[model samples]
Target chain A: MEEREISKAVIKRLPRYYRYLGELMENGVERISSGELSSRMSVTASQIRQDLNNFGGFGQQGYGYNVKYLYEEIGKILGLDKKHNMIIIGGGNLGQALANYVDFEKRGFYIKGIFDVNPVLKGLSVRGIPIHMLDDLESFIRDEQIQIAALTLPKSKAEEMTALLVKYGIKAIWNFAHIDLDVPSDVLVENVHLSESLMQLSYNITRYEKEHPRS
Target chain B: MEEREISKAVIKRLPRYYRYLGELMENGVERISSGELSSRMSVTASQIRQDLNNFGGFGQQGYGYNVKYLYEEIGKILGLDKKHNMIIIGGGNLGQALANYVDFEKRGFYIKGIFDVNPVLKGLSVRGIPIHMLDDLESFIRDEQIQIAALTLPKSKAEEMTALLVKYGIKAIWNFAHIDLDVPSDVLVENVHLSESLMQLSYNITRYEKEHPRS
Candidate 1:
């Protein structure tokens, strides 16, 4: 299928499908019907079928989908089949927490190093990855062939650091910074605004309470 | 406006509008036309107008929108106007990281305490909020009136802890437990699948590299 034919909304949902399938695979499930999968996911069965059909129909009419095969297929589609060298650009709480997260490595994102401007964090290591000075970022990325840089820096420093990462040939950014970055068209950015999600929770709580007021 | 008239898609976009308007207000911009705001955000002007119209039509024919007023209005709509006491149910790396995060407080979700089954973390504090044993969770929630619970626990423990939180009367759950939760209709669960976002980044990078092959 042509890339242009796929909608951005569909692209966003691909990861979710991949995750649910992964869970099923881990549970030793062999196959799943669209209806069953839809029951587990927030999406509808027809929508699930439509989404899977877009990339060439993986589901058989009656046989459903082979869990392992479908999981592998989605992983390949998401480029999780190959290991990508990544670095955290901040050695603060979020950065440190992400470095210690074992799931990233399990999903083929290898953290080569972490970089921070603070001299106090220079020698610290999280999960065996040393925290290096920001001054060493360029040389480190070059030497390590780092493909992704996770920006957990402050909003004040986000844009400047993003420019530096782009300049140093980083291909993508997983930005946790509170500011929107201005990257070149070629660079891939996935901004993870924590507060936005919290706000969504806030909205949900308010709506739920209003609808189901205590008797 | 009736609550039923507001779609979930519109509810989700409120935070982005709030964030953008907050930025504009910070820049001392008093007002903005939909066209200008649309350029800054990626949304279309018509869609932005429609979304705002869903919530009592904040825009005017010639005046566009008042930036500060719009920001505050969106904030109130998302229930960010009132402070909500919250607790982190795990004192692991992620929980510690979130506890240290100051942005939650700025958004009016106060981290009242952090709880963990591990005794080693019992007395530790992140950003002045002390970590307590899991045994203290019930009493802590009762004493503090924690409206939201952030679950940063492992997938193996998520369901058990979720049941406990529900039993303890948690109104909302900001879940990072890497598992789908089973909550009653009255409870709000916002699942933050970190790996899914990472996979999206991986896919975007792969797609970009494939399309823009190096010369």
Candidate 2:
């Protein structure tokens, strides 16, 4: 339980850290201290220690950390060691773009199929992944052993498809739709409310200005 | 200065609270307490109080909080006042869907234009917003006063567009392109790494199971 809360914050930052670590590992850096990591990442050293403490004190007081070991540990914490088979719902620009996306695949998720209600899009191949009609969603998820679902559908259709995913036994959903969904208390849904994010960024500009105070 | 760090956390959670409050507002909820808000939100009450304390203590001793006032205050804090002009880059399914979205306008965000390098997509109306060529991005952003930009471009192009936006004096970009962007330190580039979010959900399921000891 002590580890879980810290992991939440750590998990959010892991992707950014991974990109940096990947560069370091690629460059053959073999060790890093919390101080070194903090300096490189522009965060406080204590923050690095606290975040790492949640996953057991993996760093020694003076010995620093093995870059390879820490990178692997972060990968394990982020569940990047395991490949996640995913399905995209919508088969539109977002869906097609995801199907062809090299980034997710590099990051440990693979899109196996795209689903849409439109028959015209069905049987179409986007970046090598087949587009199936809505009815095939259940079978594709089950047969492909798809573990995650990406909801890029419209708000009107999002809830309906979410229910279908839950009914079909999908464990998690990355919802791109702009609606709040009421799932069973256990289902994990991250609603990517794009507008709200924009609002936050706009507010951040104000927040940053307030903090820095121009000199 | 006393509230800076606390405010960042509170500010992020404000949108979540707003969504929850939006539901209650529709349900005609007139008043709520910190305890009630905590229970409904699955968060700690002390955390709620501390967050609220980032600003002046607005919650009365026993009378709780007036829902309407809180909602309006959060909206203002989040910079959700009036409409925010936005441009959708890439004109793919996700971009078109964003342009086609009616909810953004309802949420005080206006989709001003859609841009694509494709000639076929140009000169067309995406959800009534004119789809322009990528070449016109600078003129369009300046003329329309667009501060918010959503990138649905392929990963390779995401970073390029982000720098372009910074060049055009755009302060914030909601990146949907799934790439880590290098922008000027001053620009607020919010990269919603979809893959990382999905990984978090997957990892959370494992953590949730362990904590609950599900049979």
Candidate 3:
């Protein structure tokens, strides 16, 4: 299939559209107009039409978009149609929480294993996924053909683990660590900087207060 | 202080600058030229100078920017210098993990309480923060003067909980639920949409594979 480059902003919105469409599918909705989808979401009807038009314009002349078809297509575009083996590089609360999320599995990203430096947690399991010692990381990734690794380790250990993951041939990283990781251009890293989000909230609150002073 | 309008893009970059400058401070780096900082970060030197220039351009003509002073100024701009009282709505693993994270407190975001609909989880403490029943959320918010609420609840309950939270006067929300919330114009919400981030990783990995096909 011939593919054209999609803008980053449009790529960012794909997952959101997939999510809403998934919800609609769950509710047994068969089809939806751009106007209806727009009403359901924050995106404007014209914006929805424009974004979808980038992917060959799914909607018919008057008959709206087929919800399931749109949802599946978006999921495929996101590479969610294929199964991806994943491992958690930390067994801390955050890592375990991610392992227990259960949503990732539904999206075809399976948590094949969990690794940690702590000896005590090595034998434990989260949601039946066994935790392994850091010593086992190399063999496990190789054997499982793990493509994506989630880094939930501390700031002090993030860079070291990142280097190790790269060396072991991991292609993608979902980093929760505070520090940035230096990786090869071919490798992908998506950072979930919780503190940064908090800072954004703080900035918004400050701006709001400045605009609306109490009498 | 005279405050000029800052763009959304600039606001997004503030946290990153804050993080990088913090690392410089920790490494005992006293000052850094824009060129040197550019080499360390992905951003270009001219872009760094332009971004900083938005806030009165702190860099000296020839010397450099004082790392500690720049960090402090960015932190103040991000509103990290002031304390924010926060409550997590949900006593699940995600909520517990957020409560256990010590970094938020260091950045002046305190998780004062955790609330859950599960009676079994009530009275349990995560990092010494007490877990209360959902029924007590209203009183807790009022009594503690809570400024921020973190929603780690399931999507099914997110909207109802958001309504209650808004009614109870939460100024800012860190939403983890897989649903977009409707809030008053004055209220602020920062969504940590993990699925969206994962999809982004998936898309990147797919693009990489397509570009560098194994011979």
Each model's total of backbone clashes? 0, 2, 0
- In Å, residue A62's CA in model 3 sits off its true spot by 1.5
- Ranking the candidates on lDDT from highest down gives 3, 1, 2
Residue-wise C-alpha lDDT for candidate 3, range A1-215, written one tens digit per residue: 45898899999999999999999999999999999999999889999999999888889979999999999888888999999999998888888889997899999999999998888896889999999998888999999999999999898899999999999999899999987789998889999998898899999988888789988
Give the range where candidate 1 chain A is weakest over 10 consecutive residues by summed lDDT: A1-10
Top candidate on TM-score is 3
TM-score of 1: 0.95
Best by lDDT: 3
Task: Identify the superior model by lDDT, candidate 1 or candidate 2.
Answer: 1
- Cα deviation of B61 in candidate 2 (Å)? 5.8
Q: Mark the regions of model 1 whose C-alpha exceeds 4 Å error after superposition.
A: A1-4, B2-4
Model 2 TM-score (B-chain only):
0.89
> Which runs in model 3 stand beyond 4 Å of their true positions?
none
Query: What RMSD, rounded to one decimal, does every model reach?
Result: 1.7, 4.0, 1.5
Better of 2 and 3 by lDDT: 3
Residue B164 deviation, candidate 3, in Å?
1.3
Q: Is candidate 1 or candidate 2 better by TM-score?
A: 1
lDDT of candidate model 1 versus the reference: 0.89
- DockQ of candidate 1 is 0.79
lDDT of 1 at A21: 89
Task: Give the C-alpha lDDT of model 3.
Answer: 0.92
Tens digits of per-residue lDDT, candidate 3, B48-153, equal: 9999999988899899899999999999888889999999998887898899889899889989999998989878899899999977888899999999999999
